[model samples]
Target: MKQGIHPENYRLVVFKDMSNGDAFLCRSTVNSKETIKWEDGNEYPLIKLEISNTSHPFFTGKNVLVDTAGRIDKFKRKYAKK
Candidate 1:
């Protein structure tokens, strides 16, 4: 490990899973303008996430669709010519 390579501004931040509205507090150096009052009566930086371990298909053992880039339609169109 090299010195000065890690950020010293690691503070408790609230990460919310936007898909499921689940929020958890953890140390993070990431910056966010949004703030939310946590359960501990403290306001923390809110980071909205599309998926988390709780809502992910791999962790929850369920099929989930995440189409941020329309890859499925592109693939189908490309293969439909055959």
Candidate 2:
């Protein structure tokens, strides 16, 4: 391995804020925000996420609808023409 030629690897926490609940886990991601404290007396940047495995409908054995790119309506419109 070479020195000064590789990106820095640091420890950070990932927080998921889902409709059902919230969770925290250790991960390596890029962030430029200030530090934040956790209940375990550890401090890291506060990263807020919308979904994770805990609350994802597929993982939780429930049905869900995710329409982020308007694909649902696009498919409907295209299929309805035939």
Candidate 3:
């Protein structure tokens, strides 16, 4: 263990906003422009996520098309050989 040579480790919150819902949980990640109000009415570093366990189809047991933009089709058309 070294002092003054390692990055700061602090408690932070990760917020997930997805098609299923939104949730907040504690994590340790870096963020430059995210903030969240804690239970004690204090602001802390926050990370915004698009997909998480709650919204993931595999975890929810729901068959869903996660991609709304035709990205899969575009990829196939571009890479798949005729």
**Which prediction has the highest lDDT against the true structure?**
1
Give the poorly placed runs of model 1, Cα more than 4 Å off: 66-82
TM-scores for candidates 1 onward, in order: 0.77, 0.56, 0.58
Q: What lDDT score belongs to each candidate, Candidate 1 first?
A: 0.91, 0.70, 0.69
Better of 1 and 2 by lDDT: 1
Question: What is every candidate's alpha-carbon RMSD to the true fold?
Answer: 2.7, 4.2, 4.0
The residue-by-residue lDDT of candidate 3 on 13-64, one tens digit each, is 6575655557676756466476767667878766656677877789889887
Over 4 Å off in model 3, which ranges?
1-8, 38-40, 68-82
Q: Which tens-of-lDDT digit does each residue in 6-71 have in candidate 1?
A: 889999999998878899999999999999999999999999998899899899998987664678
Residue-level lDDT of model 2, residues 23-81, one tens digit each, is 57676667747566777888877766666776778887978865546789999999998
- Among the numbered candidates, top TM-score falls to 1
lDDT score at residue 69, model 3, on the 0-100 scale: 64
Query: How do these models rank on TM-score, best leading?
Result: 1, 3, 2
